[model samples]
Target: MTVSRFYSPQSIAEATAILRQQSGCQVLAGGTDLLVQMRNGVKQPEYIVDIKEIPGIRDVTLTNQGLTLGAAAPAQSVTERPDIAAAYPGLVEAIDMIGSTQIQGRCSVGGNLCNASPAADTVPALIAVGAVCHVVGGEGVRQVRVEDFNTGPGENCLKRDELLISLFIPRPGVGSADAYLRFTPRTEMDIAVVGAGVSLSLDPMGTVSAARVAIGAAAPTALLVEEAAAAIIGTTLEESALAALAAAAGAAASPISDKRGSAGYRTKVVGVMARRAAQIACDRAQQRQRRAH
Candidate 1:
């Protein structure tokens, strides 16, 4: 197998035009996943349109709505953003845990989501933060919630010629914090057996105002447990509430037995991770609230 044709586009318009004109053309961002798949003969694209050279695709900006992370922005870039780390620690933590420093240098969040791996670390964090994906195609642009982005394992709603433009993460309020946690056989360089991220917001009276909990690796795509979140809203987190949320989180998982972990273990760990992450996020949220006062 050989990559015979490579097209490097200088602009998004050129990339979109190339994609529309070429058949079997795979859009290449960082090539961290695509190159490996191609080399392993898992995928063989007739044309590779390299989008890394396109300008303005790597910007990370803080906006009134929240944060807009460009599709081509490297993982290292996302992990190092002080604003992102301070505002959305779960996302930063997840980004830090992805691959190694070298791999992070070459991996883009868009590429990670577009790859649509069941265990992708960033998905859970994104889902917890209520992130939306901006996609562009010949039909123009549209936004899809991160929760709805992945259709299933290794599959997403993106069309053949559509490209992910950026990710939009809503800003957490002043009294909010987020945490991401994952369990694996070894630390670093290993895919998660089960991963969870939680974002919690406290009201002025020290009660829970809003919450979002998302789990990964325990489901075909990132799973949002709304019922678990509802269990904690409108009150300070209690042990019993946390337990209920954990159980709900575990019950929502639909995992399969695989070499990395069993479905039972995945379910149990998803609960543990979700509970601990929620507690951690609550503590952090309290600290942020105190600091703001």
Candidate 2:
């Protein structure tokens, strides 16, 4: 590890100013990922800008419009909120898989995202739910779709001087629900071999209305598959529609062969995962719809 200067920025302005003025500086959130990288010598920064001290950066606010999750909010804190879980169950499911109970106290949803791992559990869920990254820098603030935030493995679109402030997720409508599923070697605390997230709504007539499907661990980044969603958007989620959804999801995968699974195996598995996740989402949406009526 390299010797580094640490700055606890008390505000967003101070954080951004440090980022703009300092070279080779890295933002420290929950540090579940960054600290490990530093210890392993994968990352050696000259300065560490700890944003935990920033006001409102660790808060979780949900309004009539949507959810605003602070960049440094602990995973446990967010997941423990009944309102958050009720509104976004798929997202809660993903965050719940981040690590053991001890790690969850220190890990964060935003940090998991900024790590930019292809297999990060939360990315696909966030993308499926239409989550947007709120970025701030000397250039000012901008909103980026979560799907577009990551460019590749361990890489994101944020400039060196930019900081991810928070995440904004749109409110799910009536008769809508979501689900996430991942195939891991173990039942717990293992990386995903292939992950799928589905968010969908059922019209009053029980036909599919709006839907989004996203796949992770089978691509350079989590991908939003329009074709997979389109496969079931108009019809009721019948057997044929699910088969098409699986096929489209399989066709979208571009994975590298690894010890856990082969490229071909992952491609096929992601499709299956997507199909299953979609079914789960559909079932949840139906249940919600029944209650709404």
Candidate 3:
């Protein structure tokens, strides 16, 4: 058995320094994914840098401008904040599905995103809401859109010396809302066969003024489906628009055949999931509009 050295860093600079010095060091936020991979020999790291000890890494802040979610914040912590839940219900729903109750206590959204799994439920939702990743490194801090963060399966844009700090999301408009839905073989603890997330803003006349559509488990990385969003942008989410959105979603997906489902099946099902999620988002947008008045 290979014994790895563990270091708990209390500051971002300290953590980044450790990451820069170590060649094969793994950052541990929640350890839900890392520990499992370590045990299975999927990842063999010589050093483990625990960033959970960093100040404010687990804090959740919400303001009028939007939200600043700590990268290491646990799923349970995010779900417990009523302000966060109300402001981004679709994101909350995705976080809630991270794992079971026990796992939720330790699973962090940052870890989920860093894991870079194509089926990560939160990635699609994050992309739909236009979330941006806050990263720090030797060169200083920089921001990357959630949709552009992940490069491929189990890979991301972060450099060896970089660390993700938090995520920022702009405040939704009065008539804006979002929704997320995923298909899995089991009800819980199973990878998504397909995941769809949609966010839309409605005008006073109920026309969709803006929209974003994203999907997971259909490619090497979670995808932002601009064509799907374009399909519903000028309409009131009517059946004709939904049908077009679905078709666009199906067209954008490039899944592969596997045990859980086949490529053709995933392609077709992603359309259904995207359509349903859009309907849910539209309904939520209407509700937001009613409440704002």
Question: Model 3 misses residue 282 by how many Å?
Answer: 0.5
> In lDDT terms, how accurate is model 3?
0.94
RMSD of 1: 1.1
Over 135-191, each residue of candidate 1 has an lDDT whose tens digit, in order, gives 888889899999999999879998776888899999888899999999999997999
Model 3 weakest lDDT span, ten residues long: 1-10
How does each model score on TM-score?
Answer: 0.97, 0.99, 0.98
Q: List RMSD in Å for every model shown.
A: 1.1, 0.8, 0.8
Note the Cα lDDT for every prediction shown: 0.90, 0.94, 0.94
**Which residue pairs collide in model 2, if any?**
none
Q: Each candidate: how many clashes? A: 0, 0, 0
Per-residue CA lDDT of model 2 for 119-191, tens digit only, reads: 9999999999999999998899999999999999999999878999999999898799999999999999999
lDDT by residue for model 3 (108-221), tens: 999999999999999999999999999999999999999999999999999999999999999999999999999998998888999999999999999999999999999999
- Candidate 2 overall lDDT versus native: 0.94
State how far residue 287 of model 1 sits from its true place (Å): 0.6
**For model 3, which pairs clash?**
none
lDDT at 96, model 2: 97
